[model samples]
Target chain A: MTLHAIDLSVSRGGVAVLEGLNFSLSPGTALVLRGPNGSGKTTLLRTVAGLQPPLAGRVEGGGEEIAYAAHADGLKAMLSVSENLSFWASVFGTGDIVAALRAFDLEALSDRLAGTLSAGQKRRLGLARLMVTGRAIWVLDEPTVSLDAASVELFAAAVRTHLGQGGSALIATHIDLGLDTELLDVTPFRAVWRASDPDEAFL
Target chain B: MIALLTRDLRLGVRAGGGFGLGLAFFLIVTVLVPFSIGPESALLARIAPGILWLGALLACLLSLDRILALDWEDGSLDLLATAPLPMEGIVSIKALAHWITTGLPLVLVAPALGVLLNLPGPGYLWVTASLLLGTPALSVIGTFGAALTVGIKRGGLLLSLLVLPLYVPTLIFGAEVARRGAAGLEVVTPLTMLAGITFGVIALLPFASAAVLRINLR
Candidate 1:
């Protein structure tokens, strides 16, 4: 499946941040979104993931089979690693969390509560959720935040494997993951602040 | 849906999930009511049904924020929104989990507390019956309130402000059923109205809640 965002415009707090943004992700490919903080990269990824609608334009091929991993891990601290993976796996109607655990190198910590894991371990658990989702397009925002060098490599390998299996990923990151992927800098699509608007008064 | 419900139930049972909080609040409020009003059996019995209803309502409210705030904070809502299940199903399951973990307990334990209130013998069954029929609405409607104020910081006050008015109808009909049953009057009318409210909210509020959650997610 090819995810397309054509002439997309996204807003934050009722103000347009990125405008006329166009992008597409073909199968077995990766797109790295690059922009400074507050540049609407997150907003754009969110729009493409269908979490929130775009102010204008539409995202084609996002109805189903798209998994979004926000900065937060979304893990239940009370649930162990395997339990958290199983919850998401069941939620996405996928089967077998063993591969996800092994892929993220979380097999050793499978029985430990998510709250008990270190920051990097928790992040791995979060990223492993993508594998359990069985989704074609993985929309990840700053997925490598707390990961160390080896863990980043683990995440990169997981993404590579996902792409090799004809899956696609849209990632926003400042660090290079050393992958054959396309880089999209959203700086060009930054929307100018419009001074005159009816809703501006409310702000 | 069952998976979500089970996960929520597990979370509620775990430490710091606020599962015990609502029940504890209900018990404390029920125990304090008689002390505040003085121990006159007639007065206590006369007002017991309403006090119990109020206590249940407030107790439900106490756990309302837990319905979505934790999910929202931990970013579970975002992932769940993108899951295969519809948003309506997600909110509905959350409401069901809340009702099971919070509302159902209050219903079961109300009779025990009714003794403390000197509730008339006839009032016991009616109170339980009314609560059994009514707390589902409280959970459903409170889910909407939680979704509505989910974006606000420290929105507990705002949440209560949004939900208390909605609870008025449920509270009135529910208390009326118990009060009428206690007085040996016909309980059919109020009981019917309470059932209507519960079924109506349970059937419709999930849509509104899902919509509000989508907006908040934006």
Candidate 2:
């Protein structure tokens, strides 16, 4: 099975921000979405993950196979590191969080409150969520923000492991994640503003 | 659903998690009413049922924002939306959690607060019973308001405005039950209506709350 975005058009705040996008992601491959700021990278990822409906066309094959991680970590500050991981694991119908904790090298901080973790540690905890999702396709928006060099390497390794297991990923970030993946520049798909249209003028 | 409920309960009980805030507010409001209304025992007893109902309603409102706002702010709501659990189930679980954290406490504590208000002896049981039956509806309806305003910054005020009017039917029936019971009048009608409203809202409002949440997230 494969994740396919057929001529997808995504909108934010009732305004089209990207249009005419087409891509397919087969198992065991990764697609790195490269784009400048405000180029709808987050929107595209959200659409692919089925969190928001695309304005036009369709994203086929996501169904229950996609796990999305936005800029917001989704980690509860009141919960401990392991509690956070286990909570998501249980939500996603999985029970084991050991692999996720070990994957992110978070075993040591398992009992620490998430609120007390450093920025990089929190990001790592966020990235560790992908492992417990039990989904084949990961849709990540700026997954590496605030990660230190070593944590970045850990994230890349995690992505490699995910791809090695016949899974696919669609990552939207500017920095190189140090993985052998196909690059799709989202800038070309950016929606253009036309002054002739009154609706466009308001934007 | 159980996982979500437990997680929410755990968070609510934790430090800085707002578990006791609603109960505290309820206590404060109940305590303050005696001073404002003076030391007239007859008057306090007469208005005690209404005052207690108002206090409980306000207490429920005080904690409504916590039902979904914490999850939304921490991005857990997005993850919840993407999970296998249906939105309706998620909203229901949140309402349950809200009842556990806010409504249940109000019900348990209303009897003691009724003493301070100089409520008649019969009014105590009715107040507790009315709150126990009606507060679930308050929590459920409040979940709808929380879902509607989950995306807005500092939405507590708007939530109260949107939810208070919806709370009117519950308040009317709840106060009626308590008031009738206090006066030793026939109380079955309003009690039955209050139970009906609670059961009805419990059954139906989750869909509306889930729809509102989906729209807000979109």
Question: Considering only chain A, what is the TM-score of each predicted structure?
Answer: 0.97, 0.95
- As for candidate 1, its interface RMSD to one decimal place is 0.7
State which candidate has the highest lDDT.
Answer: 1
How big is the RMSD of model 2? 1.7
Candidate 2, superposed: residue stretches over 4 Å from native: A195-203
Q: What is the TM-score of each candidate against the true structure?
A: 0.98, 0.97
TM-scores computed on chain B for all candidates: 0.98, 0.98
Question: Which candidate number has the best TM-score?
Answer: 1
- Give DockQ for candidates 1 onward, in order: 0.88, 0.81
Report the C-alpha displacement of residue B133, candidate 1, in angstroms.
0.3
Residue B182 in model 1: shift from native, Å?
1.4
Q: Model 2, chain B: what is the TM-score?
A: 0.98
lDDT of 2: 0.92
lDDT per residue as tens, model 2, B41-139:
999999999999998999889988888988899898998899999999999999999999889988998998899999999988898899899999999
